[model samples]
Target: GAGVSQSPRYKVAKRGQDVALRCDPISGHVSLFWYQQALGQGPEFLTYFQNEAQLDKSGLPSDRFFAERPEGSVSTLKIQRTQQEDSAVYLCASSTDRGSVADTQYFGPGTRLTVL
Candidate 1:
């Protein structure tokens, strides 16, 4: 892809339902990241992947959240038993530099999840 792309720009899920959001990063990007942005707040890093390796997942709120980048190009974020507190905009970003402080990430428009 030319840029980061995310699917289902908007999603509405029942309180206990599960949902999957997808991301397609730019071609040849070495680093992929997932972030959660609550309304009126800055995006919070959820996980990071360097190629096929999941290097960090310290920011995931709970075990109910899972993310994977199998081929190091496309990624998925699955949230199980969604809660009202889980409603937020899920963003995917990619960079050519992996875990470098100077890396500039290009972000997707995001999937806006609304749990009711």
Candidate 2:
């Protein structure tokens, strides 16, 4: 892929169900980030990874949310015990910079997860 790509572009999950979202970043990008965007609101940072090491996860809303970037290029965001509040678009982005705060990120189309 020339840019970031995400799997399961759209997902519908019943309450209590678990879901995993996949993200494949551009080759050689060293920084990856996960964000959650609610209706009419901007994306909120969820986590960040530099290479295969998770450097920040303080923005994750709860323990039910987890993200990993093993081997550095591919990442996954998992939400366990889904709730209605979890309904939102999960976005994955990558940057060529080494996890710098000012890095310009290229985003994927995102996976829209709807919880019922």
Candidate 1 lDDT, tens digit per residue, 1-116? 37899998999999999999999999999999999999999999999999999999999999999999998889999999999999999999999986468899999999999999
Q: Candidate 2 clashing pairs?
A: none
Model 1: lDDT of residue 6: 98
Q: Score candidate 1 by TM-score against the native.
A: 0.95
lDDT of 1: 0.95
Q: List where candidate 2 sits over 4 angstroms from the true fold.
A: 98-101
What's the CA error at residue 84 for candidate 1, in Å?
0.6
